[model samples]
Structure formats: C-alpha cells, structure tokens
Target chain A: MLKNVFVLALIVVLTLPGCTMEKKEKEQGYTARDELLGTEIIINIKNSKEAPGACDDIFERIKQIQGKMTVHNIESEIAILNANAGVKKVSLSQDTYNVLQEALTLSSLTGGAFDPTVGPLVKLWGFDSKNFGVPTDKEIQDKLNLVDYRQLQIEKSRDTFMAMLPRDGQAVDLGGIAKGYAGDEAKRILLSHGIKQGIINLGGNIVAVGTKEGGSAWRVGIQNPLAPRGTFLGILQLKDKAVVTSGGYERYFYENGNRYHHIIDPQTGFPSESDLLSVTIIANQSLMSDALSTGVFVMGLYKGLELMEELEGVEAIFVTRDKKVFITSGIRDIFQLIDGDFSYEQYK
Target chain B: MTVILVMNNINKWITGGLIVLAGLSFIVLYIYQGSQDHGQPVLVIYKNGALYQKLNLTKDLHKEFNVTSGGHFNTIEIKGKAVRIKEADCPRKICVHTGWLHKPGQIAVCMPNRLKISIEGRSDNVDDISF
Candidate 1:
C-alpha cells in the first residue's frame, strides 16, 4: 500500500504541471446523433467526450433529418412525397431526392427483385402495420397487381416523383428499400456533422460509419434463426462494413402449422419457398447490403451463391432449412459456428 | 486427539475431491473434441427426367466416369478441391460450380442434366444457427 501510494503521488506530481501546461487538449474530433426512421431507429456514435455540444448537436441534426425522410413523420418530405403520388408537381429537398435516386437505382440493379414498391404487398400481408399475419390469395393477387417498381417514376428534372399504376388506379409502396436508403442518408448527415465511428440500425438494415478506435475491428453478431434472441452463431469482424440479415424468423406468422413470412417472391406474390431460412450479406455500402439481402433471399441458394461469388466485395452466410451452413469465400475464416451440432461446410 | 483427527479427515477429503474433479474435466474435454467427427455427403445424378442417385461422398471419394452415351454434350469441370459440376446440356447450369464433393456442403448441380451433388455435414443435431 505504501509503495502504491508513493507511486500515485509521484505520478500526480509529475503530471500536474503537464496538465496545466497543455492548454489545447480539450478539443475532440468526433460527434454522433440518432433520428427516428418511421417508428423505430437505433443509432450509436462513439467520440471523444471533450467536446461538450457535439452530442446534442448530432442528436438534433438526426431528428431534423428524420423530419425530412421518415414516412411516419406526417409532415416529413417522404410522407408528402408519398401522399402526392399522382397529382401535383411537388418539389423535394436535395436529401429526399438523393435517397429516392438511390432507391430507384437499387431497385433496377436487382432486376426488380428488391422492389421498393413492395408497400402494397407488405400492407396486404399486414406487415406494414407491425402486424405479422397472412392475407388471402385474392388479397395477395390484388396487391401484387399494384407492386410494379417500373411504374414508380421520378422526374427529378421537374423536382416531381410519381408512382403511376399500370391501370387506372393503383398505389405504390416504397417500404422495402426506404428504411435502408434513409439510414444511408442519415449516416451521411452525421458524417457532414464531422461525426464518425457510429452505427445506424434502422429496422434490420445497418450502416456503420468510419472505423473504431485502437484499430480494433467491430464484431457483429448474426442472429440465429432458431434462437430467440441474443444467441449468435459467431462474430464477423467488420471495418466500415455494413451487415444486413433477412430471415423468415425476423417476421413470420404461424397458421395451421404453416408459416408465412414478410419476404414475398414477386413472381408468385407469396412468401418465397426457397430452402434458405436466412441470409446475411456483408458489403462496404449499406445500401448494397440492404438491397442484396432481400434480392439474394428471394433468389434462393443456387442463384444467390452465384451472385455472391460474382460480386467482388460481397460475402454471405446462408442457413438452410436442414440447419446446413454455407458461407462465401470472403468470410469463411471469420465465421465460427457455435452451439450447434451442425456441420460447417463451404461451397467452392 | 480430536483436533488431529478432524484435520487429517479434512485433508484427505479435499485431496480426493480435487483428483476426481481433474479426472472428470479431462474426460469431458476428450469427449468434446472427439464428438465433432461426422461426415455425410449427398451426390445427386441428374438424368432425363428422374434424379439418378444421391451418393454419400464422405463414404466414397474416387468414384468417376463419363456422362456421354449419345451425341448430347455436357461439359464437366472441377472447380475446387472437392467440387465438380456439368456446365451445359439443357436448362440450369447449377452443377457447373459443384466441382467434386470433397468438402462438406459442397454441391454440384446439373441444371439441364438435372444432376445434383451435395456434401452434407453434421448439422441435423443443431437446433439453431445463431448470428
């Protein structure tokens, strides 16, 4: 105890003058904020606490951003965009315009597999209202008729966007890709605030910014399909990478021992019957991960694996119905299968 | 006499318990490492209309032959260490990447020829694959 006290006093005495001498040590270079996207949003930012106003400033900025993008925000630009689907030529904020552009681009890239106009299909399935129940065949078919993304056109030159139905009257749904697009924009807003080292988990799509300190990689745990919560297969170490997981388990309804999920195949207008239960995609761009997660899930295993292999920077982990595990070559090393009596196999 | 006797009894009991615990720990560790050794493979041969056979690659590895009996041509290639696939013949080229089934979960699917080769591992026992 005497030796420890002597060392402590010596350290304090030695540091006291240095602390007073260094006058400009309080300025930090990190800030963060969170904005509610629709009804749910999870935002985390890590920065130096020396800057007192950075946190509050970031938080307020996020709220302001959400006010423009969230569809649930009644006066939000997105809500206005959705409300005036076919009528007046409404001008849009630059942020909203940029997000819509990305949404349209991703929808085209997936060949309509990841359509943002899935709002009608989602609502028909009762998933949009936070209700995880199935609708009838007629309802699905009717909604399917309203779910063509090609009809959702954006005339940016006129600052006008329209969701034109193929027939006389059909509504457009931008639910599938809006949250992800919003999350990406929110990250941009935070970055513009000079905030780095943060994660934006809107619904299930996640966008991480910058890299963590100490050169340590961020280990994101993938949710197990069979496990209720908190249980994970293994950790994937990421550095400025976004990981998005789509699974039947995330949202499903059990009726008469048959389970129906939120992910519907556009070709069938019903839940995908693919053997895969869940798929998680890791990409540098959060939007790609978001769009690819849904596209790959609907494509099933064969085409999904091929697409993953064809892409340069994308890696995926697929869980099949029989609990079989398949991982892309990019992430085979980092994934560790835990707590399961299953076999760890790689598709060459 | 009583004090000496109590101390002696306590020492013996503690020593015996430690020895038992150490032995049990070793036994458990050995079983755990040994239990992960299950290999099962499914090799599916695609033909005209029916799937020919689902062979277990874990049980057999060096089995090979040709896929030509008539003028119908199907290109076969080995892509990886233990995966082989048939490139073309008809509809789906899924078997093109299957290579030869050497690793677990490695599959060869012939889309046009309707052949599928899959190597399955010990996954049935796992109730869930968590994130």
Candidate 2:
C-alpha cells in the first residue's frame, strides 16, 4: 500500500508541470480570422472570455468603416464625394473625415509623394479593377493632372465636416490608409473591452496591443521581398505599436519582362522605380505607419531615411534592391535580422 | 528480531520496485520527447472562415487537390513537407504567387475567394507577420 502511494505521488509530480502548461496555453486567448477590406484580417485576443464578444464588435466596426471608405461601394461616402468632385462640398462622416485628415497630413508631410488623389492613377493602371496593364504616357499624364493631394479640400462647420475635390476628375482612394485606420479602430475596440493584450492584423498592417503572455514583447516578422510571402528577413519585437510595410512585390504584373507594381510614383505617374524594394514603418499609430510606408517607398532611400529620422516616434526599415537592410536608430536593437542573405546597417 | 528481519525485507522490495519504476518512467519520457521532435506539420485550409480540410504534410506528399467555392477554385499541391496553391482562378493570383508554405506561421490567402491555407505546427516563431 505504501509503495502504491509513492508511485501515485510520483506520477502526480511528473505530470503537474505539463498540466499547468496546458492550462496556461488555453488561457492564452482566442484567435479569429475574416475577410475584410479586400484582404484577410486576423484578430487575436489574450483574454479568452472576452474574445468572442470583442471580435464581433471589432468586425462590425470594420465593416462600417469599409462601407464608408471603399471607393467600390457606390453608396460609400468616398464614392459620393468622388461623384461631387468640382461640383459641391459633400458632407462626411466623422470616421471618413478623420481618415482623410490623417491622409492629407501625410500627403503634405511627404510633399505629395503619397497622394490620396492617386485614385485616378490607380484606376488607370487597372490596380483597382485587377486588369493590370501599363498605361500609355498620355493616359498616365492625363491621370497625373488630377492626382494632386492639394486639390483635396476639407472643411468644418461646427459639428459637421465636409470634403471636396476642386478638380472634376480628381478622386480620393483610401487604399493606402484605410486598413491602418481599421486596425486602429480594432485596437480601440479591444482596449475598450478591457482586453489589453492582443494582436490585430488587418491584411499586413499589424497593431500589437500590450505584450504577449508573460510580459514578453510580440514578435512580428518583416517579409523578405525577394522570397516567398512567408519568408522573413527580420523580426521586430514590439509592444503597443504598429508595423506597416509597402512593397512592389505585394501587387504587380509583368509586362514585356518588366514588372509594373501597384505603388505608383505621383511624380513619374508610373510604378515607383525607387532603389528600395520595400519600406516598413514602425509607429505608434497604424494610420501613420501605413501612409508613411507608401510615402517613403515613393520617396526612395535617401529622402525616405531623412524623413523617418526627422519624425518623432517613427522608425523605418528599408530593404534596398541590393539586399541591404537599413533601419532607423530606434529600431536597431529590437529589429533582429534572422536571414543571413541580407546585411543590415543602422542609418547614420 | 523476527519482525525486524521482515521490516528489512519489505524495505528492500520497496526500494527495488521504485528503482524499476523510475527507470521505466525515464524511458517513457525519452520516447515521448523523441516523438515530439518528429511531430508532423499539418496543412490547415480554411474556406470562408470555416475549416475546409487538414492535411498531414508528411503523409500527403505530392497530393494535388482542388478547393472550390462560389464558382472560384484554387489548386492546392502538397509536395513533401510543403504546400502551395499551384493554380487559382482569382484574378490577381496572389495566392499562387505566394509560393510554397512549409513552416509554421506561413500562410497563403486568396482574398477574392475567401480561402486561406496555413501550415499548423506546435509553436510559431512570431506572433504575426507584416508584409
């Protein structure tokens, strides 16, 4: 009987750690995925009990945002605004106003390198329709005339906000910034539910709230542009931050052995021929990070690096065409280059 | 004196039993750990946010199948320990262009068709990936 007790006690002791580990994993949270804003979004919440309710609210909020901002939706505020271009000031929803405000700010900051008015160019290149082709110079030039962010006008009258496009053909496409806005909204929804630890991945725009379980920072990988989608060149350890990357590899088509990517340079009215293949922005807010990633990609390497350095609380990683990775000083330590093929250096 | 001798015999048997049991436990643990090291990767496919299929990469070597939904289809091929969308009816073909995904946390998504494929493993190196 005594030996039996001893054996049972030994078994309990041996399995105790495993049992507890399994319990901890179960408590780690809930993960759900859905298609939104023309991309896949995955939301992971650390609190299992609150995940279902919070995710429902988050997805609902995103759908509303998508409805208002999407140019494809004819009833969307953006499409209505486009229809009224050079005609009248259109009333805007608060969310639409806020996103447009941030987008315009980024436009001025990047000196139109990332124009919200690039909608005409986006359509001309068939990016919006996915009928990819290279447009003629005259066609591109005509679209370029209407692709000026300055023509986008926004005004406020007491509680109501309005926006207008001064030119008849000008239009606003929040494609560059909408997902980030959605991520921010999702983060807000999660936090409002008293859930502090979560990861919101809106397509590729990542917003990490708090840290992983055990107070460890969330590890986010940066895609290696030259390799397949899942391949990562480096990882960023982040907490309460947003990471956004814009690359030619994301959306492009081949024509005459040359690639025509989706990210068009407002200046050239063609796919950006920037020396860098991708630009990743790490910032406090996803909206800023998303817009800046596109803006910096258009700005090229030297100018992009300068802009990132000048901005407070903003850091960037530029993967150049030569397979060299350049990171801002702030992210130098946290960004780990795991891939050996690419060499990294801190932008002095 | 007789009781003392019996007590000694009982102690010897108990100790011997414990040693054997401990040895057996250790051997069992070793095998469990070894099996874990050889844990097979799984290809988890989701269509319209619902689990469509789960394929064992090792066992499904060179298996080719088609996943169709809403008149859209993607041809999935499992080669060795990797899986990829060999062909997709989606216009952009981004899912096909994503190439093969073998490691945990690697995912290929066809947004137009609402189809997603990922290799599921025990643990992933990163919480998420930004592209």
What TM-score would every model get versus the actual structure? 0.60, 0.89
| Clash-forming residue pairs, model 2 | none
Write one digit per residue (lDDT tens) for candidate 2, span B18-90. 6676667667667866776667788899998899898887844788899999998999998899889999888
Query: What digit string (tens of lDDT, one per residue) describes model 1 on residues A1-348?
Result: 354456545545544543443442353334332334442345666545523354455446556666776555568765665566555445667666666677777767667777766766766666655455667888878878767778766665565543333432344444555555655666766676676666666655666677655555666767666643334565677677777888776556556777677787876788888988889988877667877788888888878998889889999988888888888988877766764645566666
Tell me the tens digit of each residue's lDDT in model 2 across A1-348: 577578657866765655565577577568888788988889987666788999999999999999999998899999999999989999999999999999999999999999999988998998998677888999998998998888788988788999999889888999999998998999999999999998998888899999987899999999989877767889999989999999999988777778788999989899999999999999999999999999999999999999999999999999999999999889877999988999976566
In candidate 2, which residue ranges exceed 4 Å CA deviation?
A: A1-19, B1-37, B122-124
Q: Could you report the Cα RMSD, in angstroms, for every candidate shown? A: 19.1, 3.7
DockQ of each: 0.03, 0.49
